[model samples]
Target: MDLSTVTATLASKSYDKVADICDNLMLQVATDGIGYHDDWPYAIHLLSHFYVNDINSARFLWKSIPSSIKENKPEVTAVWRIGQKLWLRDYAGVHEAIRGFDWSQELQGFVAAFSELYTKEMFQLLLSAYSTISIADAALFLGMNEDDATSYVQQQGWTVDSASRMLTVKKQPVVTEQKLDPSKLQRLTEYVFHLEH
Candidate 1:
């Protein structure tokens, strides 16, 4: 399969077709001793995995590539770094990393795919810090409207006080057992034995 065809398929989000073409290309390169540069295929494969939220496969692909390739291709390296930040739940780091760089179409698509995940991570970060937060505040933090923020909170099983416009994270209740008196325990044991007879 032509590399341009593979690139076009990936741009069109035909992920399964891209995977098949990439796999065939890899097989050809391996068995026929064909001199094929692996960069483009790897990039497409990485994006395919990212588009599907398959971070483990993406990580494997990123790591399996030659370090020389990583060093030589700045775009690939940048994409890999962003993927790493995403995997690490460093949503802020991903935002910071992509800020000033002019990304190619493929990279732009990859970033767009990750935006929802980034927002989810941001919500988790905020929840970890505060047990209760205002829906307005959550909307602002998540870059969503108030209704959407409220919907998200409700979907997650968090309580929302519409009057206060606040979300309440229900705390798990702690249970404690009362200590038994030794004297009462002996009497209870004797009573149980008598009843058994």
Candidate 2:
């Protein structure tokens, strides 16, 4: 599929067709050294849209998610399951999957700042589920020693104990009363979760 067609399909929420087109686009970009900017590889990672509504289909499509993105972001994994729910038009399943997720604060912040900069709603959709990993998992994901991850999280104002407990978890439901600057927001969401790409 052509890039224009693929973009148009994604614009219309033709997610399955967009996925197929993206798969081909990635291969073409990889093999031919052509099309898109340097971030093309990262762009391809966005296509995985597995839906729990179609258990069999979800299982099949889940395999398409690239390892790099999957290892770093559990929300992406969850969102694919949401996509499966979207596929089957199972409103209840989608609700169940996204229950307890709160997008209000992040969405408000993003809309106040970045909504105009981005055309796609994917990041806005993802605002709720983004969270910092456990220190051990963060260490593993970052290929760092436990000490490093501890220091990093500490630097970000999180407290961790050697007993493997996150003593000061911040990704909980409460939004801070103070509004964050864009840099602080970037650190809190992007760096905290190692989703810097």
Candidate 3:
């Protein structure tokens, strides 16, 4: 494995490329040597999966890790704690986990990227789930303070009632129409007709 490539990829913050790089290197090693990837950079590799929101792959990767490695490295476990929060859809816990862990320099960029994307996703969920929510709740949901949350909501075209301190969320228009592929539908129709005949 080329440590320099991994380092440069992490610095570049191309997380998907990082995943591809690490996974390909591990596959090459496994094919040539023992079938186990015991010496891989399990922490960053697991993080790359999370960065891409590939939760199932991250879970499998975590399980593949040797017990001794997990026991000795608290940072890896700390990274997995965030993954657990994400898996459980624990939004509040996700914020707490990010703040709660003492991340090494290597992991900080990916964790930050994950937090930003997660918050954006939660904002979209808020548009769907709530027409009105208190500033405090919005702050919690967006991982910002009340003041910053107020500004953020206002920037998104959400209006705040000063007396009530509640925000009226401006939701994106929902696409309700399900477009059927005409060719596929016709093929299925013909198949069913042939079967019946």
Best by lDDT: 3
Which ranges of candidate 3 are over 4 A from the true structure? 34-39, 173-197
- Alpha carbon deviation, residue 98, candidate 1 (Å): 4.1
> For each candidate, how many residue pairs have backbone atoms clashing (under 3 Å)?
0, 4, 0
Off by over 4 Å in 2: 1-7, 14-16, 33-61, 64-66, 83-92, 99-197
Error of 3 at 114 (Å): 1.5
lDDT of 1: 0.71
Quote model 1's TM-score.
0.54
lDDT of 2 by residue, 48-90 (tens): 2231023454455466556766676555555555456556755
Question: For candidate 3, which ten residues in a row score worst on lDDT?
Answer: 31-40
Q: Candidate 3's residue-wise lDDT over 1-197, tens digit each?
A: 45677888888877778877887877877777755444568889888887788899889989988898899888889888989988998887888888898888888888888788888988988988999999999999888889998999899999999999999999877779988999999999999999999
Sort by TM-score, top down from the best: 3, 1, 2
Model 1 residue runs over 4 Å out of place are: 15-21, 98-100, 116-197
Task: Indicate whether candidate 1 or candidate 3 has the larger lDDT.
Answer: 3
Clashing pairs in 1: none
